[model samples]
Target chain A: MSLQVSKNGDVVVIEVDGQLIVGNRQELKQRVLDEAEGGARKILIDFARAGYIDSSGLGVLVSLAKRMRELGGDLRLANLNDDLQTLFELTKLDSLFQIADTRERALESF
Target chain B: MHAALDIRVPSDVQQIEAIVAQVVRRCREHRFDGRQLSLNVPVALTEALSNAILRGNGDAAGKCVRVRAEVTEMRLVLEVEDEGAGFDLEACTEDPTTPENLEREDGRGLFLMRSLMDRVERFRGDGNVVRLTLNRR
Candidate 1:
């Protein structure tokens, strides 16, 4: 799995490509945390290219949301596939995250 | 059509990605439905293998985890065996969906596997073996 971080004004859009499972979720987490620590207040994760995510990946996203909120910032998710969206709903993580339908909306939500 | 996949590797977290890839490829080749391919197998296999590597094998360098998958006309069966003693599902106290346990990082693997797969069975005799089944009809 790979993570690409780009910026839309003050919002950092992290595009995760490939499967986010136990093996690679930590890298994504570290990158997200680095962006949060580096003073990026509004973080948007674009999962348009990500096909799969396991419990570990879900955990990372949850932790990331909590971390960002603790820093007085917010983390949003964008462009999640149907399966992932279902996963979030099943796990109730959808309630915890501000998931947008598009990157534009995600950025505007901030 | 019928096929089988087998791999035995040392207990390491890094092996999960390759294993998940192989499972995905085989499932696709077997012509699983969208929900089975996009949701069930990925989540179930990753959870089962991660459990085998991290929990069942205790991440021991010398220990090995064996994964075998078979696809036939009836069902898709996956077996993951690790070198540890075993685990008691009844002993697990944490519920991932619980209000207090939702944010905990470590306890959702088993829950995800059970939720995604059609059947999740644990066999304990010589070692720990988790068998996951997904019906294909």
Candidate 2:
């Protein structure tokens, strides 16, 4: 998967493209952690282009959300497709994180 | 006559998915009227592949997973072989469809494979060979 990070004031938006499977887990985790540590607490992860995500990828997201919470910030997800939404619901992570319909909504909430 | 394609990769999940997609496409191109069968074999093979790549020979040098697809008049057979220490398939038995196990992150791959494919067979004697078959009726 390819990731692009953009900064909008204090909020950091990450756009993930392609499959978020086990191979791309480490890089994805590192990117989120780095941005969180860099003082971009309110994070928006846009998953419009993400095709699939397995358990490993979900684990990384859970860990990042926990880390961001510990840092007095939050991680929000936007543009999640039906499959990913089902996945999150199945994993009970949908209730754990703030989800929005659009990037603007996610940023505005921060 | 049946056709086959052999794919060898460094156990990367993305590459594995790509290979699975290719196998599915090939089945479609061959005019197999089994969309569900195509989805089943690939999904199951992917789970087996992930186990080999992430937990098996991922840390070892020059380790890879080999996937082979064979199409026949009666069925579609996919064999995913990994170069890792094979484990007993009989030991793992967590059902993925169970409501209690849905939230857990691990132990779902094998279950999904068994549920989706018509036949699921594991061969630890041959370096972790997982054969999935879908019969076209």
Candidate achieving the largest DockQ: 1
| lDDT of the candidates, in the order given | 0.85, 0.74
lDDT of 2: 0.74
For each candidate, the DockQ is: 0.73, 0.20
* Error of model 2, residue A21, in angstroms: 1.5
Candidate 1 lDDT for residue A30: 91
Worst 10 residues of 1 chain B by lDDT: B1-10
Model 2 bad stretches (over 4 Å): B1-3, B8-14, B27-44, B71-76, B94-108, B111-120, B133-137
Model 2 residue B52 CA deviation in Å: 1.3
- Candidate 1: where are CA atoms >4 Å away? B1-3
**Tens-digit lDDT string for candidate 2 (B1-137):** 13387777876665777787787787776667654433455545666678777777765557788777897667778877887777777888766445665445566666656665688787863577777787765
- Ten consecutive residues with minimal summed lDDT in candidate 1 chain A? A88-97
Report the C-alpha displacement of residue B29, candidate 2, in angstroms: 2.7
